[model samples]
Target chain A: MNISSHRRTRDRVVTVLTYAAMVFVLLLPFALFVGLAVKSDLLFREHSLGDLLFSSVWRPSSGEFGFKPFIVGSVYVTLLAMLISCPICLLSAIHITQYAPTRVAKVVTTAIDILAGIPSVVYGVWGMVGVVPFVGKIAGWCGIQSNGYSILAGGIVLSIMVVPFILNILMEIYRTIPRELTEVSLSLGATRWETIRDVLNRKALPGILAAFGFGFARAFGETMAVLMVVGNVVKIPEGLFDPGYPLPALIANSFGELGSIPEIESALMFAALILLVVVLIFNATLRWLIIKAERY
Target chain B: MESNMNQGKEGRNIERPFAEGESIIRVDGLNLHAGKTHILKNINVEIPKNKLTVILGPSGCGKTTLLKCMNRLTDLTPDIKVSGNIYIGEQPVFGSKTDIVALRRKMGLLSQRPFPLPMNIYNNIAYGLKLRGKYTRAELNELVEYYLRQVNLWDEVKDRLRSPAVRLSIGQQQRLCLARGLAVNPDIILADEPTSALDPVSSEAIEKQFAALSKDYTLVMVTHVLRQARRIADYVIFMYLGEVIEMRPAQEFFDDPREEQTKKYLAGAFN
Candidate 1:
């Protein structure tokens, strides 16, 4: 074959392969979800989507299924985790970029990157052993009646796990801000903190929001660390100290036990759907915020 | 080398070699080093109050560095050490007791390219005013308009004061930066090649503004363009290779140069 013909064939093959891979990667989870939902619907033909979604009970052995408690658990745990992590990550990012000396910043960033590289299971074990007791003590001091394994413990562990992710992204965003902009503010007699508040924060607001989106998504869908500490109880948690079951934790904890129970299996699939939808909605909102900021 | 002709022309030209005025900024034996490299050497010059003093030199000649030193802007650079006595009025600028922020507030700086704060046109001007003190809504609006008018930007930006400053043309942005600097009520305006990023027409506009502004505020401008120096300078400081080579009046510096380096630079022998 001539050179041009060979090149054309090679390009066509690569393009076809790439498109196939893209479609498979994008649709695999969706296809699985549809299959699971249909199978569950057929098995439990009597139950409506409302009963599967809005009902509270989720017993598997006798074939009861409801996902509301898991949904609430996911929302509350993720919200608490984000509340704990966002400010700490943001302030640490600022401190690294603005206040810390070069050596100190480098050391802090290296430690954060190492923390980010650790496996999620390792985080789970660490939380199970270390954070549970500490949180129990804090709860005792606060006059809450509980052991360490609760929503608060889950949130505390999740916040610690997601902090490095958010901090790294935020630090990168802050670093990309042109040095000239800050210099101009400082030259105008603005203090370091004022420069950060007025100039750097304003410039990086959209990116910071995106970082929060990533942190929230990770915290929401996290399974291993949350499963270890969250006291996997399928109930609407009354307070931070109450034991709860997030969607991922519920799915993981029930998948093995629900082998003979079709209705509970379908309920688990619905829980997965909720998690997927929540992530999609959050990412979409973040994209909209960034676009709005760029428009101005 | 001193020009012998200066003696003859001293009586003829009232503003002979250097314009006479109260010296607002006096740099006494300023020397600066960044790491091991000497950035500025034995710089001594008095910037006359209410006059346009242009520091003219090619790139790497320390002209811009010298301009920054007067306002203590060089302190921001790491691994840099400076030994000098810079006095703004009676206050020593480099004294350990000096408040750097307050010192910087007394001087407004315009860089080679304009960097308007990431805000709307109105906020760009109002930022400095708001920093200094509190002002009600009507007062802020009035002052923002006042500075905008001072830079000949009021009419163009009047309708779009709420829009982002980055949307303006480069020339307009430069003028807006000038207005922002002026709004702070600084005693001196320090510019480092402020017009090099601008087109000829915009450069002319900024030069015109500087000419007008010199009657009230002491202006220190740095430029590599010899023609611009001749055009806008009331007093001239010619630096070469980290040293001040010639300090003279604008006309006198062009008409007759004392140092061979200044003569060569003026003749465009080398940039």
Candidate 2:
């Protein structure tokens, strides 16, 4: 009886500790959001939300802070990256899981792991050295003036960085599908490609969307690599070759210069808040879509 | 009986005299190895046309491997070496110029558990039809209904043909898988313990369907259950340790004592 009571007490203590840990994890994002909002309250009180979001003029000395250019830049670069990476990731993942020999697939998986493990700063330097010049040549061929750093360069580098992320997820999704399903399709006389197109791809569509969502979020918030190649100019980009500044770049580049200035600090905090909220919304929307897709 | 003497093995070769043009599939000296481990050893058998042939053995006896070799489903395994010839009619299964898709179309497979394709009920049947050729929507609808009714699932699922097939009960999903396989118009049906994952009533339903189907399609089934083999098998191939111990007509093989292994396996002495 004494031993039973002791066991019960230990179990209850462990349960309470786990619940406390879960609550702490659940409250972290809310705590961060509240802290950011409180710090940005001064800027919010001085400038209307619409003016702060939509106004293009961003002169910090005169207290004119506008986030429209950075917002547009983040969207353009992220979308371009996704457009380049999604097809490549999807096809390569299919090849790895469905067609490649086991040894070759293992080799390719290890290569992707190495790519994913590389530091982001290294990618930034590589982008500065290789991609910027390539983009400059393309711009020259297209009759546009560029000194290598541009949104296109940023997009190219971002796409390369996110390839491993998206491909790993896609390969895992394809692998998790039961082998029996594929054999069933084959036994039904469907060709291997037909089985992939008609059955396996359809089954993996929701997971594919989720993978793209994660890639998009990663690309949107990337700082050092994008800042290195994106030609951080304070204006809205007119085209792919033009220079622009994303939100993360803006906060990263200016945070050190705002010494003893509450207005500038609040504006930067507001940018961080916007970044967090947008990523949260994007992830939530993807979750909703995945759930809906699974229901059918 | 045109009996052939065994060359070196201890087992005797049982070569029953088959009627002319009766055998639909023949395996000659088939041997399979996964990596270095031999899975099937010198398998020689003939599956009769339009008959239910059950490959009965204990677990890991390569019964399913033998069935998979008929349709070349074993090719999916990695590092597996197969040295043998399997003939469906007069066509060689592993010929270099063989059209694998066409060969697969001639055989349908039912796995241990039901794997309804990730699609709606109607599309599950229609998918196979669509792969063969283009069909009008009306034709697709008619054929889907016909195949669903073939498996005795039409009345139960006719109301919600558009619903996802995964929503169905396990029994219904198995029936749907049958309907999907039958829609392709295969000449042979390979079932790998088709009723093992089913309840008793669903098992009976599947058994009745198989009995009905064997009149039109050749069936090669793998099962370890002696009662199930006794109940439905028209011909029995008893395998032990990757070798066929006896291949005989179901009634004769069960009644007469032939090999010691076959007798012990039949008398519930060993699995």
Candidate 3:
């Protein structure tokens, strides 16, 4: 066949086979995560894995399994990170997009581009070496734990890490706004703030909200940075400042100590399953919001 | 056509060749610079009160630029210098410490694209009046209803005021934009290629609406379409290459265009 005709001709068998194989490849890890979590046979080798998932006491010796604490810690950190990051990220994005003089906008965008490129591990190390002491001092003053390794400290670090993500996503969203809308609003005698509040923000708010969900997803899945600052206590955190072990920390801690108890290993896998579900849900929601945002 | 209705009252100036006699806005020696390149050159014209004046031009002819200058919208761009006396009514527009908001209150402009604020239909129309605080809930409701009805969109949208203006069809959105502009009670309305994106039906509807609006508000429009210029213009200003080639009564303009380029343009020999 001629090259033009060949390009147009669809081979139904190849197309179907190709799509099925592609789906299988994509589904490989998805299937694995679910398989490892729900497999009752994996429970035979060491019931500790299944026990820690369901028991109130998560210790392997007593065969107590309870995943509620790690789930709670992840929720706390993610929520705290969102609380700290959302407005700051949006304001920064707005400033860069609308208020900054052209030169200032250029510089701010460049800075954020560089900030977003910084590795999450480096941010984690910074939280450990620099942020920990500062947080300790502040927490002590507030009659909270003197340890820097608290859910609050980790959450703040996660916020710092996710702010760039929020700002970058929202900046792109802001750029998509037609110049006509802003010019019309400003021409109508709306002040800078009014134009942004009534015209600009309302226009971009959907994408900004989607960015918040993405930031939460990133914060929820964060392991190393949260691990460094969070005290890794399995108990439920009493306040923002209290120490807690998130799912990633639980997974990380149990990985090295897996030799000590086989049930702990099972529980770690169970925790992995939970973290996987949470991040997936967050990602799905974020994607839905972004799609909805584009429709508007 | 309804344009003829509005035209009969305002087009003639006691046998003075039908210049914009009431002179709602006077432009004298206006020089607009875009990065040191003069875009509007030594311009002089008068736009009449409560009449439709259409500015016809080839592309890059500075008609849209001139429309924006009336409200100082051009000032928002950096490196664009304007040296001109643009007087709106009795006030010197370019140099007044005029409440930019209050100044914007007196005039409204529609862009080529219909940029209804990323807001509901009601809020889009309510935006301007709310800014200037002319809105009692009853007044705002009355005004929105009045303007929407005036734009011939009230019946279609009265049920969906909370729906985002973006959801409207392009023609409906343009009319919604017109209603938004009128909601604040502006004396002058400038439309820049307002129907360029719509089908013939929409363009005709907008033309009819502009004719009706001219009874109460001064209307200025910039268009590249000669047929549109013929249909709605009371006074036609023809611009070619950033200069006003001719300003004449609309009938005289279409009947015997003064400039060769204007003749060529009306004859459809390239923009």
Candidate 4:
């Protein structure tokens, strides 16, 4: 082969090797998680397949199985996180996008960046000392059960943490709109608020909605902070203040409970599966919204 | 035109500028300064009623500034000072305590380039009406259709009134803007280089529409396009360096050009 063709072959070989390395990197954890989910033994040493998924006795000593309650608790907490975060994040995004002056937006946006950079563990600890008791008081006033480590507490803190992320992304979207459009509205005799509401908000709706979804996903898949704030009780939450077990928390909490290898793997694999699905759905929806926004 | 001119009995003759019922808009000793920059200096001209008056000048000649000042659009800016008065049909336009909104509603302003709002065709046409708080649902539909038809845009947009106004071609968007300006039902139309963005065919269409509109409404157009002015102007006001050098009937100004600047400008030797 000529030197040029030989070089092309080298480039092709490098490309294949790079892809193979990436696949090798990705496949390890994926296979581990999937294998743990399907493994029969709570301890993976002897048997490969087990019916731990359908069993009810979560006691690993007795070789009992099933994580139905844990799954329900995870879904409940994640959904609650969305309900709490979506509106607050979207409102702040609109405020920053439509109302905040340039300097104020810059300063406030930088503050949100700082917020995102704070450790999730710090949020968890802060919630333990700062947020749980306040939630308990609110729940007491509302005549709910007197537990502060409730799903509601976790969701609220998670919502606050994810708001900055959404606001930052959405500010960029608003900035992308042409200044001439706003000028046209003003020249038409529309007031500033009217211009924002009728023109800017409507134009930025899809991007704002995407921001909402992103905040929701971030709050939903959170682990350390949510686990700290969310009560690690093994039951479904009856209300905001009720004790609950999110999936990540269950994996974390139940790992110690498992005496055998199978039980630990089962919990980790189940939690990973749930999170992957949620993340995919969240991103897919956001992508669809971006496309829709561009078309209009 | 014959009745308006009078000759003085002297070795040196005198010329009269005004005619009976001809001074539709009169600006006297107008001076405008923005901070330290004096944009206009003693601008005085009486625009003829029911005529298509064209204001011609080079860039930064205060032609657009004067058009803006005609209806308080200039007042939308702050830190500006203006001396003297402007009268529209005997009413002082920028008079103290003038209702700014009311003043603007009576005049239509078409910007240099098309700016179609982020709305559908029907909504774009009805935007002004909605702001003015007039019309029921049926009435709004009727008014939108009427104005769109008047601007020759109804047939093309009737099927897609829900599509965004931005999707329209630039020429169509310009006409949509015209329709929007007309829907407000103003007495005078002010066009600031309205055809500069359009092709010759579109420019001709807009010129023809302006001619038709002049029968019902007064028009003051600011244009750099000499051919366009020569094609349709009834009255011509030439401004150089922020002052009106000459104002005359279109035939008199173009055929028998007088002031040195006007002569030079018309000859394409200078703007």
Among all candidates shown, the one with the greatest DockQ = 2
- Candidates sorted on DockQ, descending: 2, 3, 1, 4
- Tens-digit lDDT track of model 4 for B1-271: 1222222112212122547566677776678998899998777677877679999877889998898888766654556899866777767767787765666666777877887776777788888888767689999999999999998988999999989888998888889988888887777888899999998788887898999999988899999877888889988888889887888888888899889998888788434
DockQ of each: 0.51, 0.74, 0.53, 0.22
Worst 10 residues of 4 chain A by lDDT: A40-49
- Model 3 steric clash pairs: A48-A263, A49-A266, A49-A267, A52-A65, A55-A65, A57-A64
Candidate 3 structure quality by residue, lDDT tens digits, B1-271: 1233122222431211354448787776678998868899867777888889999988899999989888888766767887756778767777756666677778888889799887789888888878868558999898889889989999999999988788999999999988888877789998999999998999899999999889999999999888888888899988887877888889998998878988888888434
lDDT for each residue of candidate 1 in B96-213, tens digit (9 for 90 to 100): 8988888888899899998888899999999999988899999999999999999999999999999999999999999999999999999999998999999999999999999999
Clashing pairs in 1: B17-B249
Worst 10-residue lDDT window for candidate 2 chain B reads B1-10
* Cα DockQ of the candidate 4 complex: 0.22
Off by over 4 Å in 3: A1-29, A39-56, A143-145, A187-189, A259-261, A283-296, B1-21, B35-38, B75-79, B132-139, B159-162, B259-264, B267-271
Off by over 4 Å in 4: A1-101, A145-147, A186-189, A251-260, A286-295, B1-113, B134-137, B188-192, B218-226, B229-271
lDDT (Cα, tens digit) per residue for candidate 3, span A15-56: 888999999999987797877576434544555544545454
**In CAPRI terms, where does candidate 1 land?**
medium
Q: Which stretches of candidate 1 lie over 4 Å from their true place?
A: A1-45, B1-21, B269-271
List lDDT for all candidates, in order: 0.85, 0.90, 0.80, 0.75
Report the C-alpha lDDT of model 2 over B1-271, residue by residue, as the tens digit: 1233232232534243356468888776788999889999988778889999989988999999888888888777778888867878888787688888898988989999999998999999998988778999999999999999999999999999999999999899999999899999999999999999999999999999999999999999999888888889999998999988778888887888588998887777434
